[model samples]
Target: MSGLRLEPVTFAQACAFVDEQHRHHRAPRGHKFSIGAAQGERLVGVAIVGRPVARHYDTGRALEVTRVATDGTRNACSTLLSAAWRAGRALGYERMITYTRSDEDGASLRAAGWEPVAVRPPRRGWSCPSRPRAGGEVEQVGRTLWQAPGSAQAPS
Candidate 1:
């Protein structure tokens, strides 16, 4: 981990790497930016930031961490989370948020200075005929939303 670096990456590259290494093996759509963590020349992890998928959070100043994928590299997740926040701030976003399934630990997010803000209730699958979605393993699970530290105030 000595030569680890965080750098901007294209959505295609991030999606490819995430599909290979992420547990769910699913790539998110509509990311605004993707950042990668590299160990020397090899990519170890990625974080995808984008507009919030939830309609309630679609404000112009709020962004979301859509995905974080890693190849089991220590500290990669936390590093990518931190870098995502820095990138968002640089781009003038007021708040950054993300969600983790209830059963999943939030150590990486906490290490990146994010705080658990709320626990969202489980939802039924979103597979209506008009808006069919590929069923996901965590689709119906409860999730805990986390926000970057100091973003408690409403986004401007």
Candidate 2:
């Protein structure tokens, strides 16, 4: 193995990463994963996963992915997705899922094992968590969006 490592992000780190994403002009609604790809002291990529409601489809849990970026030269999609997968699994989720616009190119997700179950635009009027980040600057993610892994579906 070429020495690849993944780490779980703390709430503080998650807030910082989400702030960075917001600075970069991306939506920071769902960002629970917050993984970093580093070789020693250098960070090569970032991947974040969050649990949201599966309202888009009639079934399955919504595991949203955000800020999946790599150093162009290195293929980081697999590493990132794998980290998110492990996190989701650790959280007790049985299956993983994501969403993308109908016209958007989701090659990275496809390459990383995220299958597109729907092509519809995300629903309007998302609700955020009642409690915000401790700091007035950072906002906490929505609570209603996510469900415990085993709780979403009963054994079939």
TM-score to true structure, per model: 0.88, 0.56
Tens digit per residue, CA lDDT, model 2, 1-156: 145566555545555544554333253566555787666665555676765434443244446554455554255556776677777777766665554444446666666655544344343334447533443342322221222223344224
lDDT of 1 by residue, 60-156 (tens): 8889999999988899999999889888888998889999998899999999899998898887765667777896434667899999977746543
Cα distance off (Å), candidate 1, residue 66: 0.4
Which parts of model 2 are misplaced by more than 4 Å?
Answer: 1-3, 14-32, 53-62, 71-73, 122-156
Candidate 1 worst ten-residue window by lDDT: 147-156
Note the clash tally of each candidate: 0, 2
lDDT of each: 0.87, 0.52
RMSD (CA, angstroms), candidate 2: 7.8
